[model samples]
Every structure is written in C-alpha cells, then in structure tokens.
Target: MSDQPAAAEPGRLTTREAAGRLGVKPETVYAYVSRGQLSSRRAPGGRGSTFDAAEVEALAARGARREPPLSGSDLAFRTGVTLIDPDAGHYYFRGVDATELAGRYGYEEVAEWLWTGTLRPGVRFTAPPEALEAGRRAAGALPVHSTAMDRLRAAAVAASAADPLRFDLSPDAVLRTARALIPALVGSLPAEGARDADADRLAQRLWRRLTAHEPDEGSLAVLEAALVLLIDHDLAASTLATRVAASARAHPYAVVSAGLGALEGPLHGAASGLAHRMLAEVLERGGAAPVVADHLRSGRRVPGLGHRLYRGEDPRAGALFALLDRVPAAGPALAAARDVVATTARHTDLYANVDLALAVLSVASGMRAEAGEALFAVARTAGWIAHALEEYAERPLRLRPRGQYTGPQPAQPLP
Candidate 1:
C-alpha cells in the first residue's frame, strides 16, 4: 500500500459534501446547525460557509461517545450560560434567539419552553383539587399585606408541610406535584378567603387579582412578557440551590424552598429590588445624569448596571426596555432612570441585568418596590422546577460535601 497520506479534499465541502461524508442528507446538516449540533464558519468571500474536516470528525466522535445522550444537561454545558462564551463573548439560551424571544414571546411562553423541551403551541396548566387546598393553606401562612411573591413562597412552604408525600423525591412524583402546584402557587395570590382556586382559571384570575390596580392591555402584556423573560436562565444561584436539594433527593416543593432560601440573599433574588429602590432614590434626588455621575465619582457601584454575564447588554433588559417604551415616560423618574442607565453604560462594560430592568418595569407597572423581590421569586420558580426536573431525571445520589480538616486533632476524652 502507498505510504502517502490521503489527498486533501478540494476547497471547502458544501453542506451536501459534508452530509454525504456523514451519510446523511443536506437537510440534516441544516437541522444540525439550527440546533447548534454542528458548527460552521463563514467563508473568506462569503459565498456560503465552510466546515473544518477535523472539527466535523471530532463532533462525530463526540456524538458517538455520548452516554447520557445530551438531554437535560445540554443547556447547562452549551452556549450562553452564566459564564460568557470566550468566542461569542455573550450568552444564549439553548441556542434559541434570546433577543427575538425576549422581544417577541410573552414571559409565559418563554417559561413553558424552558421547562419542557420545546414550546408547545397551545399548552395550558390545569390544576388538581389538592392544589387548591394547598393554595388556600399557602395564602394563610404569608404575612398579611406582604408582596405577592412572599405569599407564594409562604404558600409553597405551607403546602409542602401539608403533604406527607411531598418529601418523596421520585422524578415522576416531583413533576406531578409541580404541575399540580404551580398554578395554585400563582392563584393563591389574592389573600386566602378573597380568592377561590380553580386550577384552569388560576393563572388568568391571578393576573387580574394580584395587581393593586386594574391592568391596561399594554401593562398586562408587558407583565406577561416579563414573566416569560425572567422564567429561567440555565443554573442561576437559586437554580443551583434547587439542584443541590434535588441531589439530596428532596421533593419538588422542598427543592423550590431551597431555591427561595438562596434567592433571599442580596446577591441573588433581592438584587433587582435594590436596583429598583436605588433608581427611585436617584430619581427622587434630582435627575438621572447627576445622580449617576455622583454614583460613579463616589465609587459607589450602581445597582442594575453590572452582571456576571453579558458584557454588552442583558437580553432581558433590552426586551423589557422595549416593552416599557410602549408606555409614556411622563415624569422625571422615567427620564432619570433612563439617564442613569445611559451614563452607566458609558463607563462600564456591564449593562443592566434582568433585575435592573425588572425593577424599572415593576415600578412603571405600579408594583410596590417592597413587593418586587417576591415577584422575582415567583418568576424564578419556573426555572427551579426545570432544574429540579433535570436533577430528578438524572437521579443523582445524595449530596455530601467533603471538607479539608483545619482544626486540631481530637483531644483525650473529657472528665
């Protein structure tokens, strides 16, 4: 046999050539690209695209070697998560168009897509009877006149306490419980006796029932959009907390409670509320430009300006701001907030994360600043459920952390 290496294929192979090599049709190649299953680079002259032979071979090898089959963990490992991509220098959501989704889809649709593998065309949550009782119990446990979010958390805690079966961490049970509970979680918002629970009507009723004032069509639409956009983003700190609970084989509600505990911290769920309050403070003091400049000069970190991910812009912020634009900016507060954002953008690489934008949107929508954190918790519960589902499906063993011993060796027994 000749000792020479195989001859290099001429130029770049089209999709047809690449697919032919892979023993699949060209359409399959397009699908691969669409799902982010394959990578291709733009050509020098830009006629189409080129795929490296070595890269394709590596991908094929990886595909062949996949054991878990890249189901639940796909979003966690791939593009646009907490760590910004070194190549793209931005985050993405499951390779879906985050910008478009943020702009186009309501928050509910976005959330549904996050939880299930795909966005169902006309899916709805229908609650079971147990859910209504759970909802009533949850409502009573919350502090009177608390934020809507607080009531929801308290309800979740109460409902968990009420259910003996809740502690069971079986995957199917967890999902069933979540499906039964989420609508009630939302529905129980209007103070126990004031509202009645019927699972099918809970989401719709709660939307109208929770708001302190009547929601105009635009405001309601914006609120729905916010819910969708805030629904999930890979493994946030709270999501991680839920996963940890799941790893411990905690039930779904317990897992969510774990997530809520994490969210209570200032660095996580409370950040947006802080941002909202800070913006209000700035607006109250004078105007956005001066307050922002003073903040920068004083070395005070502006709330809602920086994020761990998204160097240029937070996709959620862009989506929210665009939605907010539909409403009139009638007062100094609106202009000031905008000015602060504009000025802050000039100095820092970080733009507003979801919290900052949510703060502004919440205020614009007439939600009390105190209640904003609770709303955020509600929005994020969807993600917690998604993570819990993944963890339950994987059936991970109990979480037991190993620690390096730093203390002195054991002494003799005490007298």
Candidate 2:
C-alpha cells in the first residue's frame, strides 16, 4: 500500500447531500439551519455554503431512532442543569451577568439578551418616548380603571395578538418580535407620569405600578432578587413544553403558549400558589408552631417547605430568607413556616423550595395574594425565551408522537 492514507470519500458535502444522508428533505435541512441546528460558517472565497461532514454525521447519529419519541420534557430532563450560585448568581444577557446587568442595564437590554441569545451590536435601553405614551393609551383602552394585573394582561395579550409575525418561529423574526412586543407589554400598564417615569426601568418601576403603593426599597430588592434567582432553572416543565413545540417548528408564540399552558397547571409553576394558600391557612389558625404542627399532623403538606430538586436546603430560599431579615414582622411567618418545614423534613427529604420563600416575601411586602402568580408568570418569561432560543437552534424533530393503543381500534364505526 502507498504510504499516504487512502483519499477520504469526498469529505466535502453540500447541504443537499447532508440532508440526503440524514434521510430528511432539503427543506428540512434548511429548517435545521434556520433553527440553529447544524453549525455553519461562510465558505472562503465562495458564493455557496459548506458543512462539516463529521459534525453533520455526529448530529444524525445522536438523533438516530431514539425511543419514546423525544419531547420537550425529555430534552429538559436529559440536559444537564448548571446550578446557579445563589448569592453570587448573575444572569448575563447573552454574556453579561444578570446581577451586574439588572441595576446598570435597562429591561430592554435584558429582554434582548433573553431572546436573541446575546445582546446584538449597539444594544442599549433608552426610555422610549412612545413607550410611556403607548402605555398610557393602552391603559386608557382597558376598562377605565382595572387592577395592575388587568392592565398587564390586557396589554400583553393585545400586543401579542397584534404582532402578525408572533407566530413565526424563525430566529430573526422571533428576536425582532421580542424586541418590539416585550417593551410595549411592560411599559403600557397603569397610567404613566409617576415620580419615576423611566419606562425602561424594569423591576422596581413595574413593582411600583403593580402595588399602587410607594415602592419599598427592601421589598423591591427582595422581589428583584426573587426574579433574578428564579428567572431560569434548568429544563423546567414549562420550558420543556416550549422547546418541544419549537422542535416541531411551531411558531414562537405557539411554543410560548404551550409552555404557558403547561405552567398554568397546579403541579408545575402553580406550586407557589399552593404555598401561599398554605401560609394563609397557617396565619388564620394563629401564627403558632402548634397550629402548623396540627396541620402537618392532619396530613396536609406545607406548600413551600419541600422541593424536588434540593434534598437539604434550596439555595435560593436561603438567599431570599437572608434578605428578608430587615423587614418588619416578616420574621414570625417565616419562622413559623420554617418550623413546619423542619418538622416535615424529619419525615421527608423536602427542603424549602422557592415557592415557600416567595410566598413569605410577597406577603410580607404586602402584595396582593393573586399577584405572586402574575409575578411568576413574568419572571418565567425569561426562561421561556431561553428554551425557545435553544429550540430554534436545535430544530429537533416534530413534537407529534405515536401512541400506544389500549382500547379497540377505529373499526366498528357505529356499534
């Protein structure tokens, strides 16, 4: 044999050839690229594009004939979770850490990072003149005087519906829609012209509008911390739902809708609601350890005490609890809640999940009972976009799956 290795069989493959090897159509291959599936770079001195045969082959092999049909939840559960460092945990928009970014950067900057995977060149927040004007107009359109949440939900639904391209799942369109719609939704709520009128001011400003009370620095800080902490958690149920839909090439709004539907359930994101209700019950029974003990003895699980992820203590809970130290009368409820948690932990491995701490924090800060869910909905939007972006990139198989037949088939049409 010659000393030189045998020539590799035409190492270079066009997109069409790569699609053929993968048993998918050319359009499907293009769909993948649009969704950020296969990595590509511009060919040197060429008009057409080129792909790495090795990379394409590896991706195909990994996707080959997997069982149970990949779903969003499956991907989420399988993808390794990077545990956030609670105290030092910083959310970077694209690359900038969130902790550093939140106070320094505007909400628009953060939103851009969440949607586009990175802050595009020259991304910065300037309070939109129209943002305040549009906010006032949107609020006026609502039923004269609605609750803070009413204004928020109305603005969001109306804005989303108005975006003709909201259904488009393509990377460029989704990012464009996000930039246009998100600021409108956040800004156009409650009448403007407040002491602080920066429509671009995110967490604190929004909190002020929602509460209809002067923003308490401590409470606002606590709320912001909660948002920052919970903004993303590895592949959560709702996040998975969004990803799965995105995999199917569903529209971005559709994908987000799927995730929101999943979140609306009691088991997933609504767990915080249960925690709040549980604490309310405890308060009604007199803020005493014995009352909590009796409730536990009666087979009622305290809502916020236990979590599925952290076996000992949830780091987010610890951070929030530490911050609440300065607030007045915030101690008793938290203490009683912790007492219940400790008592329950002796029997189960449950630790205080974020829900419990949030209930305490929100309630202590005097937010309306119904507001926590809305806050959670807002916070989770960040994660929803993150998952959507990933889906846009991966462009995995469609979400539809074959089902196991249990009952008789569609025969005997009219029995």
Best by TM-score: 1
Taking every candidate in turn, the Cα RMSD to the unseen true structure, in Å, is 11.6, 9.2
Summarize candidate 2's per-residue lDDT along 1-415 as a digit string, tens digits.
Answer: 1111222235655655666777775444444543344544333443333456886788688873232554654433332112344444322333344445444444444555454333433353332444435545666687754654455455555565555556665455555555544455456655232545444345665575456655556767777676666666666787777778777777655665566567766676667767776676667776546655666689876677655555556766777787677666577668756766876766666778778887787566556565566566666666666566655545368455677889976766786
TM-score of each: 0.71, 0.66
lDDT of each: 0.62, 0.58
Index of the highest-lDDT prediction: 1
Per-residue CA lDDT of model 1 for 1-415, tens digit only, reads 1111233245445555566666654444443443345555544453334556765666667762243644544334322222335235444555565656655665555555554333544455655656667776767666667666566777787677767788665433554577666766776666322444343232344455444555566656656666666666667788878878876778888888888888888888788777778778776776667767777789888877766765666777777677777766423445656777777777766566777776776666565664457666767777677666556544356345567998777894775
- The residue-level lDDT of candidate 2 at 63 comes to 76
Give the distance in Å from residue 43's predicted Cα in candidate 1 to where it truly belongs: 44
Off by over 4 Å in 1: 1-90, 145-149, 162-172, 191-210, 293-300, 329-334, 345-349, 412-415
TM-score of model 2 relative to the true fold?
0.66
